[model samples]
Target: MATKSNSTKTSSSKKGKMNLKDIPFSKERLIELFRQMLLGRRFEEKCGQQYQMKKFSGFCHLYIGQEAVAVGSIAALEIGKDYVFTTYRDHVHALILGISAKEVMAELFMKRTGSSHGKGGSMHFYNGKTRFMGGNGIVGGHTPLATGAAFASKYRGDGAVALCYMGDAAVNQGTFHESLNMAGLWGLPIVYIVENNIYGMGTSTERSCAQPELWKRTGDAYNIPGRQVNGMDMLEVYEATRQAVEDARNGQPVFLEMLCYRYRGHSMSDPATTYRTKDEVGQWRMKDPIERLKEQFPTVFTESMVKDMEEEIKQEVADSIKFAEDSELPELSDIWTDVCVDYPGYPGREASDNKYEFPYEQLENAKK
Candidate 1:
């Protein structure tokens, strides 16, 4: 696969603009990046089709326009070494991490064959082999968990790093600060990536954030190194993420904010818009990342090649949906099977579940 990243792999300027001239690695690599991106787009469209047929019936956050970050970061990462955790918009990361489309589709269908065995639906994807953490649903709760994962990596003296992904809305939460402080103070090997999509669930950036220059957020006592990149550009994201991961492995944690946009609503449940204007959306549509990259990448591939790639991705996505549709749903018996470790006598047969209540009470009791 062509590397196709925009990263210079050199020290960035203080403002953190990546030198993208070094990203396009090889023809094969560019095509690979293009294929992965097409797959992500097709997956979202397939999800919409499945949902319309009632095969998937929960909160589904599609990764239609947000493919570059996942593809870029995952390209820079190793399956077993680096860990990735992200918000509910995580199918792209899971897909990039080698989770089977059959299992992912089955999970969306609420079948026992799901990656999380039907327990973790669209928002709770998991795969142990790839080291992807979860499709966390809480607003900003997963930041500390990312820190802890890096802390664990450090504790084991493994050079592995943790890649924490979240959105612009999440940066406003207290955990974002707390986790950054802990990671910087203790020097955890973590890359805090904020996918700034410009809108956080209908809220404008300036209206919600006190200071929307989100990359500069690492300036507090923790002194985390921060950078801003063009998220829509895979090369830009790849360049920024490569350095950030390298810096983390060297004991300097990095915070990165990428400016991007979502082409759709918050989820399948939400109408396309209640906050932003169509004119604004159309303006962004002019800068379509996929189209721009298709031209930028292939010296030989043509418009027909682009069309052929689209067709191939659509076929794969269609097959994935069929696999999910034909797949069976989790049995009622499966409902009780994954409750707890003691739910079964066998040591390895144990399963995990979403805690019944917020774990605060349990934490308070333990403190007492």
Candidate 2:
């Protein structure tokens, strides 16, 4: 068993004690992390604008304030060799995994060029080749799926780890417990990340959970190593995830609770201000992940460079929108095409003529 690491906090609050030189990442890597976080924020901002303009038909969840949690955590993974999963707020995860902004935008616009061929909307963006398992709609539903992936990796000795991202509220679901039990028992290489943004759709964690410190609660339950990091601080998130990933790859299950916040509402439909105060939101804005990173390395990210990066990101976002708009929608007949296949002597549903009724309905005395 891997020795459990102590709960850690490496946020900006310790700025006086820790300087930029104290951090381990290289200048280039730090810049890349900032770019990734900025890109996710920009992409989601575009998504929110499109949702308001009715360019997309389904639900949209913006990962505005939680960029660090996705970018920092994913940076630790060996892409293509490892796997990733998340809930509906998954645009950031997909973008971080090397999926083009155009592919995700096209998916939102229901264009045939989308990752899911425009079939799976915002919530169901998938790319099996990239190993990003995509998002799920149900609360805590994907937990088991991630655990199963870890099981397969261990069985095949693939040396792969599964990174599962879930919200704070999802920890209460039964699948969370069941999956953790199985992972702990089998020593599967999986890490359960709870993006604890405090509010589970307007209700604060204190009101909903008995123990608000989720890192401790879930960790103690399954005896899996866990850590709580300031999600708003990208460096802290990166460091914590690096350790967790190391433990997981060595056949030890891990849990992580990212103490973060979301600037927007649960979904595009919600206003997000009725339950929380504007002052509270303002406080978090002061700790914006992008700004915090820039502050830590002022020399690396000068004002002029920051401005240039902003302009570059804006142009990239514009191009993605244009690409999605120019793309065509899926043909009506294509609807069930990618779903499955039919074979000789084992025809698919449409190819079969047999009809059947329920066993209870087949009884002569049963009511229609």
Candidate 3:
């Protein structure tokens, strides 16, 4: 097991000390991390704007303040070789994992060019080539799927590791426990990350969980080593993930609780203010991940460099919106496509002789 760092601060009160010399990444890599976080921040901000303009429908959860949790941890992994699974608040993760911004935005617009081909909107972005498993909707549902991915890697003797991300609320679900038990028992190469932003929907962790110190939740039961890191600090998230990934590759499963916060509501329909105070939100915002990175490395992230990056990101996001707007929606025939894999000797291997019909049309005819 990787030794825990005494310097890892769980709360925003201390704003843990970050030494530039301690960061394993080069200066250029540090700048790249900043850019990734900035891109995520800008992209999510645009998503909120588009949602308000009614450009897309359905539940839209923003990873507004939690940019570091995705950017930092992903930076530690070998992208195409390793696998990643995240919850519905997943646009940022998709972007960081090399899913083109245009494809992700198009997915949000429900266009045919989406990662999931307009069928799996908002909470279902997928990229098989990159091995980004999915943007799963159910609270704790994807845990088992991630465990299976780790099992596959171990079965194949592949050195790849699987990283599963979830919210604080998901810890209470039975699947979370079941999946971890399997991983621990089988020594699967996986890392279970809980983005404990203190709230599960409108309910705070104190109310929803009997023990809110989430990092400690998995260790005793599963024999998996668990650690809490300042998710707001990208470097800390990266370092911890790097060690955990090493351990996972050696057939040891680990649990990480990223102490972070989301600036947006649970979904687009939620106002978020009903449950939390403006003062509390402000405090977390002061410890914003993007700003914290800038403060930690002023020499690397100069004002001009940051301004240039922001402008470039701004245009990139704008182009993505244009691409989504110009792209066509999925063809009506697409409804029957990609639903299931077909193979020889399968029950429905032959094409249907009957013409395809829309289900809603049938319902309308029945009403008549």
Compared with the true structure, the alpha-carbon lDDT of candidate 2 equals: 0.85
- lDDT by residue (tens digit), candidate 2, 30-71: 888899998899888988998889898778888999998998
- Across 1-368, the per-residue lDDT of candidate 3 in tens digits comes to 43432223344323544566877878888888888899999999999999999999999999999999999999999988999999999999999887899999999999999888899888998888879998999999999999999999999998999999999999999999999999988999999999999998999999999988888877767878888888988877887899889989988898999999999898999988889999989999999998888887777777998999999999999999999999999987676676667522333433553453347888989999
Candidate 2 lowest-lDDT run of ten: 9-18
lDDT measured at residue 141 in model 1 versus the true structure, 0 to 100:
90
Please, what is the whole-model Cα lDDT of each candidate in the order they appear? 0.79, 0.85, 0.88
Ranking by TM-score: 3, 2, 1
What is the C-alpha lDDT profile of model 1 across 217-284, one tens digit per residue? 67454668777877777776887888789889877788888777778888887676778889988876
* Clashes, model 3: 0
As a TM-score, model 3 comes out at: 0.90
Model 1 spans with C-alpha error above 4 angstroms: 1-21, 344-368
**What is the number of backbone collisions in each predicted candidate, taken in the order shown?**
7, 0, 0
Misplaced by over 4 Å in model 2 are 1-21, 343-368
